[model samples]
Target: MRLNPYGEDPVRLATSLTTSPPLTAEELTARCVGAGVVLEQAATADDLAEVNVFLGRWLRVVEASNPQARAALLNELLAESSAYPRLTDHAGDGWHIHYRDYGLPVARLLRALISVGTALHLTGRGMHRLSRCELTECRNPFADFSRGGQQRYCSPTCANRDAVRRHRAKRALAS
Candidate 1:
């Protein structure tokens, strides 16, 4: 069985892009390269602009009101971005499956990767796996890679903060 390239990596990359977005095309290119994504072309200013817009749509998937809404939004992305499965050996790493066509620009490439990756992550894990932090101050979106499927915050810092807050509230109520 082949491990599809569109898996956990893209969703996490999508989360990172949506959370602390790159300010420049070079930065975006650097981030993608850093994340182990093969660059078909170097990102340009236009690519950065396009990706920013695409990320807004991606965030909608994260912020959907319910499971159906979430699936609907993600379906929109999948329909708009991904293509029929294709085979590739990008960088000669070995033959693997790709969901987008060859030689796409950075913006389109990212859209395909993020959309397909998010779908795989949600379907394989749980719909509840993709979510924003529960902490009101920091609503960062995260892909819950937890074993228990009970992630509510974007990070441990936010989780611990909320826990402390809850504990303090309970103590105050007791007092």
Candidate 2:
């Protein structure tokens, strides 16, 4: 069965790219493919540049502190990359939904995927689930898909670091 690609995967891909961006068009294509995005067009140098621009805007949605602000930012992105939704069985994969029409270039595809994926993530989970890591120094964005929706750190290492810091602070205060 084909899984929905418009949820956790795209958000994770966005976070991964934002944290450590792809240095080349080939790298970007590989990263997207690894994230389950099938690129129909060849990734060009200009596509990489355009995608970086989109990523900058996409990160704003992640960094927005309030739901209204996040929604507004996301709406702006949707407006910029808006396309009618359609169903397709491309790649012989079972019928699945796509937010953008077919035959789009790689850069445009990223915009639609990231924007629509983000919308689905926030609406399906909770707007609060998308956030930056709580560790002060590590500002990576993450989409919490855990059962409780209470994730704070981007990774276990950051969580451990924050826990240790908190423990040391408490001990220092007790002394």
Candidate 3:
């Protein structure tokens, strides 16, 4: 059975992009491909700029505090980059779903992918599951797929840093 391509992968890809944006079209395309996107067009500088704009808007959705506000923001993104859902086997990976039409530019593809993926990720997991790391110094956005649904830090490093800080604070309080 074909896995849902519109789920975790896109959200993770968006997080990665937001954390460290690509500097060039080549780098952007490489990152997308690395994240499981199959590109059909040659990426251009214009595409990179367009994607940066989309990412800016997407980051707003990530930073939104309330569910209603987040939904409104995401709906706006979907309206901007939406197409009729179509079934495609362009890559012969499998007969899967595409929320966009073929031949769209790379930026448009990314817009659609991120919008749909975020929606799926929130609904499938939980709306409260997506958040920035709780570590005061690291505000990286993360999609929590943890079994307990309590993930706060972006990675183990952040978790460790926070733990060390907490330990130091306790020791100081004892002194």
lDDT score for candidate 1 against the true structure:
0.93
Please give the lDDT score for candidate 3. Answer: 0.90
Write candidate 1's Cα lDDT for 1-175 as tens digits: 6567799999989999988999999999999999989997899999999999999999998988888999999999999999999777777878988999888999999999999999999899998888899999999999999999999999999999999999999999999
| Candidate 3 residue-wise lDDT, 7-45, digit = tens | 889899989998999999999999989888999976789
lDDT of 2 at 22: 91
Model 2 TM-score is 0.95
How close is each model in CA RMSD to the real structure?
A: 1.2, 1.1, 0.9
Whole-model lDDT per candidate: 0.93, 0.88, 0.90
The count of residue-pair clashes in candidate 3 stands at: 0
Most lDDT-accurate candidate: 1
Count of backbone collisions within predicted model 2: 0
How much is the lDDT of residue 33 in candidate 1? 98
Tens digit of lDDT per residue, candidate 2, span 56-175? 999899889899999999999988885888888887878889888788888888888889989999999899988989899998888898999999999999999999999999999999
Listed per model in order, the count of residue pairs whose N, CA or C atoms clash below 3 Å is 0, 0, 0
Error of 2 at 7 (Å): 1.7
At residue 133, give the lDDT of candidate 1.
97
Q: Each model's TM-score, in the order given?
A: 0.96, 0.95, 0.97
